[model samples]
Target: MKSYTIEEINAILKGELIGHTTEKIVGPEELEKAQANHITFIGSSTYAKLWAKSKASAAIVNETLSVEPGDDRALIKVKNADLAMAKILELYNPPKPHFDIDIHPTAVIHASASIGKGCIVGANCYVGKDVVLEKEVVLYPNVCVFDETIIGEATVVWSGTVIRERCIIGSNCIFHTNVSIGADGFGYRPSDDGRGLTKIPQIGNVVIGHYVEIGANSCVDRAKFSATIIGDGCKIDNLVQIAHNSVMGRSCIMAGHSGLAGSVTLGDGVIIGGSASIKDHTTIHSGATVGAGSGVMNNVAAGQTVLGYPAQEAREMLKQWVAMRRLAKK
Candidate 1:
């Protein structure tokens, strides 16, 4: 375990130290479990009250907190204690992965593929013909990179993930287990004979921008013609689906089981709550939020929060609920 003196920690967090700057901190721990030599934070009022009794040698707190007189524990006051603690935790971050052999012996790499320095290709991972993997890319077991696909620098793809042909993944992205990028979109036409459905081939690819994180079991389907784009800093939760031709802007977030149908567009910072579903070809403007389990069948304007089936503004939906309750009592 690594250790830092309270003085060093204070310098790192840029916090005002109230007392005993020389106490040693070994690690960060939960408030209930923290003891001497461990650093913790009080990010909420509930936790703030508990701070007086916590066994931790020091705490990260806001400047507004009042330190009781005669308490021996040191206090580091910052503007946002939670954010400060995040930085403090990063100080002891584990080293990035490195291996003696860049490519695992069990991994298959095509001769035509271009792999940059510091790449780690794990067992059973396939690098198809003409694939390009930039520096420090880590492909965990059973990751399959299809032909002509490109993965940018410092990207880590976990086990059982597939990147289909011609897809582009940008730098510092993370694809969790079982993520499927560039899968054929669901498109079909009724057969002339009225007996079967004819498939429409998905001819395009998926473009994942920098700093994207797609959680386990999520899928981004390939566009019918142009690229399906996931903008920079977007976070897609587990079991989410981004359908054909959907374009998401920077920092958009989709919670678990949320889905966007064909041709849907999301502007910057749009948030889709858990189990929300957007109708096909819908446009959700910047900073809009869709409430949990809502079915959005129309466009959501910029900075709006929508809720309920055939989703409406949150306040309107609440008023409807109030009216419904009054009618039920009658």
Candidate 2:
């Protein structure tokens, strides 16, 4: 286990230290579960007020919060308590799963495939014909890279991931277990004979940008014509579904179970909350936030916050909710 003195932690966070400076912090823990040797964080006023009763020996507190250290404890005041806690957690993070630099004997690599220097292909991995894995790429067990796919430098793809043909994955991207990239989009039409449904041929690929992290079991469907693009620094949570031809701009976030329908366009910094669903062809402009469980049925203006079913502006939704509650009481 790693240990840091209060002075050392304060120096690392570049925070203002108050009270005892010699206490040893063994690790970080939740505010409610912290012990004398554990450090916790206070990001909100409520947490700050609870610090007096917490057993933690040290705490990283938000600079705006009015808090003081308890007897024999210490406080490190930083600009952002959450960010400071992230840094501290990095200090004690365990090592990732180990894979050797060489491909495992159980793996299958096609003759035309290019495995880059320092790449690790784990057991049962399949690299298809004409595939290219850039330098330092790591594929965990049972990963399937389809024909002509290109994974960029330092990308880590975990077990059970399937990258379909001709997809492009960017450098430093992380795709967790069971992630499916470039699956055929859901498209069908009535047959000319009026006897059955006809399936639309999806020919396009998925293009992911650098630093994007897709959580476990998320699916990015292949486009019908061109590429389904995910911009740089986007973070997609577990079980999210991004439909075909959707274009997401830089730094956008989709929480767990959120879904975007076909041809949806999200501008930079858009946030889709958990379980929210956007209608097909809807455009959410930059900095707009869709509230959790909202069903967005129309375009959202830039920087707007929308909530509720058939989601509208947050203020209007709240006003309607209040009015309905009052009527119900009567």
Q: Top lDDT: which candidate number? A: 2
Candidate 1 segments whose C-alpha is farther than 4 A from its true place: 21-23, 65-70, 95-98, 325-330
Q: Pick the candidate with the highest TM-score.
A: 2
lDDT of the structure predicted as candidate 1: 0.92
Candidate 1's residue-wise lDDT over 1-330, tens digit each?
789998888898888888773558998887789988888887777888887677888888887877641255788889998789889889978775555677889999999999999889988999999999999999988999999999999999999999999999999999999999999999999999999999999999999999999999999999999999999999999999999999999999999999999999999999999999999999999999999999999999999999999899999999999999999999
lDDT for 57 (candidate 2):
94
Model 2 over residues 85-175: C-alpha lDDT tens digits?
8999999898998766479999999999999999999999999999999999999999999999999999999999999999999999999
TM-score of predicted structure 2? 0.98
TM-score for each prediction? 0.91, 0.98
Q: Where's the lowest-lDDT run of ten residues in candidate 2?
A: 94-103
Count of backbone clashes, every candidate in sequence:
0, 0
